[model samples]
Target: MDLEVVEGLVTAIRPAANPTDDGAVLLPGLVDLHTHLREPGGEAQETLITGGAAAAAGGFTDVFAMANTEPVTDSVERVEWLRAHAPGDGAARIHPVAAITVGLDGDALTAMEALASAGVTLFSDDGRCVDRADLMREALHRAHRTGTVIAQHAQLADLAGNGQINAGRAARATGLPPWPASAEAAIIARDAVLAAETGGSLHVCHVSTAASVDVIRWAKSRGWPVTAEVTPHHLILTDASADSADPVNKVNPPLRGQDDVRSLRRALVDGTIDAIATDHAPHTRQSKQRPWIDAPFGMTGLETALGVVVRALLEEDALDWQLLARVMSTRPAQIGRLGPASGRLPQTGAVADFVLVEERSPVRVDPSRHLSRSKNSPFGGLELPCRVLRTVVGGRVAFEA
Candidate 1:
């Protein structure tokens, strides 16, 4: 599986006569609308180069790096600065998300129009919810004006107070506080109306609740530009991870029950959910080794995301490859405004950005082999039925296994 890339565009895929998996099962390059390349700080957890390599390993050509870094991305200057600092040779392309509010304080709005001018297509205070409805409304209005989307983390602080796992079983077993499903649904309900009223696009990040799926369905029914993304961890794992007593499973918008997983799958299949984002949050071993309640909320996902998705969605025939391409690449590219450069489908004259997926072979996820600085993966040691053999960008082999 080899190709050529010139000036960041794929030019050819050296054709083979009846090329099998050994040759390539070329699909559009994956695009993650929610990746956290923790650069500009937290380099111990992940740097631009390391994170991009992880994305490439997962067959991604572009990843939107969340703004929850040392200095939140809320200004035009910071957006430009991040672009200047992006990895020059990594296989995956990087698009930095800007914070909706200054410092993500949930109070003041950032310079949305200015940041948009600086090439920010998505904005969010992802680690924390934009708690104020008025503030959220203003942000929605501004996003409408700027032709961008306001992505929200969607957890009510009061409802998620000290919550360690899912509100029902895991929380009861662990005796940690509960993060009720209502906490997430409530925010989505409120924001959907605001997005509708403001005629702005609202992208719900890391959607984990069945109730949230209901809201997204209703919003789309009303023709509002509301989209949602689900993480591979959420699709495959559940609060049962708490049973393992591993802090690596502790993620914000904690894992839910099987019923919620079913709902999310149906939503994704039926197009209620728009994309599959990795939310590839990275954390150092020391940080994730802490108690579940004290550890940070995330895990390195770029490398294992596709395998999980294939196991959960494709193996059971719940969806097809076209839908997979839509969720993993096409839709995300549309949302990020990446055009045909990063997520174009494989074909003659197509942007040579694609991945070779070997569906017949199963492989276990080896955290030790990850390109990410952090090895905190929920899928560690778990075997999936399919593997990404190579990721190509602009005709160049960005990753090969």
Candidate 2:
């Protein structure tokens, strides 16, 4: 196949018209709606530079960096610093999401207008939900005026406090406190109402339960402008694996039952879930090696996201490639409000940002091969069918396998 790169924009892509040709499976570069490139504070686990490199290797041409940093990205200066200083080599573009609350304390709202002026398109108090309903309502009202999206982590602190795993038979068998599915569903339900009332865009991050999916579907049916994402881990694994006591299997919004897993998969296939986001929350070995309850709630997902999604969903014919593109790239860009102007493949005059995949190649997931500072993955040693051969950002080769 012949591809023309015109001034860092993909000019054209068409069939070579040759039978024995190695045709490249061209896809719009993956855009991560959720990512934690721990910088400005948690550099011990990850930095913007290293995280950008890792994203490029993972075939991502753009990523939305969460604002749960040490000094929260609640100010315009910090957002500007992240956008300007973020590493770029035709690699992934890093767009910072400013915190919704000051210092992420859930007390006062951040300067949404100032941050929006600095080019921040999204706002969140991720890693922790803004539990105060009044505070969240006010933030949503302000965000609507600023044209910024409010992405909620979707967990009720009081209900989820000290909870480790999904509240189900599995947690009961293990004698652990349950992180009730209602904990997430309740917040989504409430947020959907708030978004409807405030006329704001609401996005739920890393939705884990079947009930939450229903809430999002209901909200969307009402034309409330709500979007939701599911993590790769939640799509592939479940709490049954948690019985082994391996911290790698542990994560916030902990793994749920097989029924919930099936529901999440169906949601992805049926458009109930807007996108598949890699909540690529990386933690150090020391942090991940702690007792299950004590370990930080996250795992490395960037490098393995596409492969796992393809294997668990596409490979099984649960979803087609077009749907994959929509869920992984197109819809995410739309939800993040980065669509037409940025975060899309060049269609004539558009910017060049995309990835080429060797769909038949096998994936051997290994920490040593990953570019992130931490090496914690539940998919370690799991072989997958699809492989990313090359990634292009702004018409430049960011990664080549």
Candidate 3:
């Protein structure tokens, strides 16, 4: 189909010849619910400029930037700083996620009402769980009243303390501390109840274990206002990385076994999981090159997320384009409360935020070619399907390959 753009709006849509000639598929630009732009503090790893470019390259139009920086995004001042410094219309829009707790300390809640008024639709203490039941309950209450969401990292620190890899055989083989699946599941279960009692929307970020899936499923069955997201890395990769002991595979809520990977896929397909989020954490090369036990946990995903998802779910016929749109775009947009133009289908008079994807050719993952400042992709050197041909944000071409 031919889409005509005028002044940043899609003016018309008409069928064109050979729409499938290049195996081209146009989709609403992807929306990422979880992304770490690393600005205002960690610019050595990434900034709004580099991170937004990477997000556009991955076919994303809008990304909710997490609140885990040096000073922490917990105030109206901090959020406005992010908004003022975000990239121009040529790049993906950055929606600032405010910290649920001051400095992400998890002891005291941030000013939720003030932050919401400042345009923060999501709150989180990501990289640190709000483990205090009193604080969690109070935050949920505020989120419910403000009509925003609380996105939890969901790991009990005591259970996950010093964990280097997934628990069980993988941890045993690597001689690293084991991270129990219960650490995640237990927190999800607790938070789900808090969400229900407080009548607030809860978003579980980076659900990694099969046990976590079961908890989310149960919560949804009970009609709680709960949603969950799974990362592409978690859906496609496994704890087999324990054998390689590569720090690139080291991530928070560390990669789990194949059984968990399969469960995450099934949950995504069956509507048990609402979205696919890239916890796009980036680290400096020096920080990432440290010894396994001392190195930071992260993997750059903004440039490779779409291909990883397509490779994980397409071949099995588990997801068609429409379903793909929901998990990758629409649902995430809803969760983040991004405006109407963010995740809409291609239509006349709509703002053009979309990507043209070439489905026939697969691209080999290369960290060096990525737009992100950091090169820490776990999928490096692997071939993946669906290359993004072009990304348009507000009718402006942000990236073309």
Residues 365-388, candidate 3, lDDT per residue (tens digit)? 999999999998888889988799
Clashing pairs in 3: none
Indicate which candidate wins on lDDT.
Answer: 3
- TM-score for predicted model 3 compared with the true structure: 0.98
Task: Give the Cα RMSD of candidate 1.
Answer: 2.2
Off by over 4 Å in 1: 1-23, 340-342
Better of 2 and 3 by lDDT: 3
The sequence of per-residue lDDT tens digits that candidate 1 reaches over residues 1-401 is: 45556655656657554655554456788999998998888899898888889989999988899998888888888888888888775368889899999988888999898889888999999989999999999999999998999999999887877777889888888887788999999999999999999998899999998999998899899998899999998898888877666888888889999889989998888999999999888888898888877888888888888889888886457757788888998999988888755566665455567788887788988899898999988877899878889887766778998
lDDT of 2 at 218: 93
What TM-score, over all chains together, does every model reach? 0.94, 0.96, 0.98
Pairs of residues clashing in candidate 1: 4-395, 9-394, 10-394, 10-395
Query: What lDDT tens digits, residue by residue, belong to model 2 across residues 33-135?
Result: 8999999899999999888888888889889999999788989888888878898667688999899999999999998988888788899999989899999
Model 2 ranges off by over 4 Å: 341-343
lDDT of each: 0.86, 0.87, 0.91
* Candidate No. with top TM-score: 3
